[model samples]
Target: MVSAPLPASALPQDSKDRLRLWIRLLRASRTIEAELRERLKQQFDTTLPRFDVLAALYRSPEGMLMSDLSRYLLVSNGNVTGIIDRLVSEGLVLRARRNGDRRTSIVRLTRAGSEQFRAMAAAHEGWIDELLGGVSGNDTQRLTAMLKSFRSNWEGRE
Candidate 1:
């Protein structure tokens, strides 16, 4: 993996650009995630994974199963259990075993949790805006479009 960091022009005709893009994406994600975590921690005493679960639940149409939350949060069931336990203890989330399905538990953001998520989301939006605000609307749109295209292409899905 320590091959020469070949110049763009020096890269193989086919794979160079994509490799460069992947490198940039990984670096950018790490930087942004670190920054967001710091900001969220300072403002809300929340970790990124916690925020992610809340955000996912906040968007669920009618709450969500623990399994779904784990998948959406990209975490393991045990990890989700830890998070859910903490959230429940904080009165930020409530879990109920699905009717006729004792093995399946549904999790929902409590009133307090929903309010907290809203507040955090507002601040988060502002932070993101502050971080990317320098870019013009046109550029932002173009970037989104490009990213969407890249994702679709990479995933081989519509």
Candidate 2:
């Protein structure tokens, strides 16, 4: 036999409220992410991870090591490698081994890749604005600041 979980009433009021907030935040994030994923697929035939990779590379015009890219994205090297492989084949990115370090490679966006990402990024911004139209600019700023503080509070605990 298995034990039953505690009832919501058993939780302290503050705990319950925090739990509710977490759920609301998670649901909003998932809903927005799903919508963006669908829009990206329909509009650009791309995935969010691919867009993320491109965005990172675009920010670093020179290039980044594969390990650095993976760390920056908070993903594993293998995941970044697969995406880099695809991007390389598409001619959207170039990967060259670091000098004197054949095992490590630096990745950067090609001219065409930069152009394509710029278009996608502009559209992405519009989509986000449309989706989050209900939030006022002031509210967006407040919420962003609060979230940033929250993240800072919990940073590196994991």
RMSD (Å) of each candidate, 1 decimal: 3.6, 2.2
lDDT against true structure, model 1: 0.90
Candidate 1 at 111: error in angstroms?
0.5
- Top-scoring candidate (TM-score): 2
User: Total backbone clashes of model 1?
Assistant: 0
Query: Roughly what TM-score does model 2 have, to 2 decimal places?
Result: 0.94
**Candidate 1 residue-wise lDDT, 17-81, digit = tens:** 78888899799779888999999999898999899999999999489999988987778999999
Lowest summed lDDT over 10 consecutive residues: which window, candidate 2? Answer: 3-12
Model 2, 47-139: lDDT tens per residue? 999999999999999999999999999999999999999999999999998997999999999999999999999999999999999999999
Q: How many Å off is the CA of 99 in candidate 2?
A: 1.4
Global CA lDDT computed for model 2: 0.98
What TM-score number comes out for model 1? 0.86
Which ten-residue region of model 1 has the weakest summed lDDT? Answer: 149-158
Per-prediction tally of clashes: 0, 0
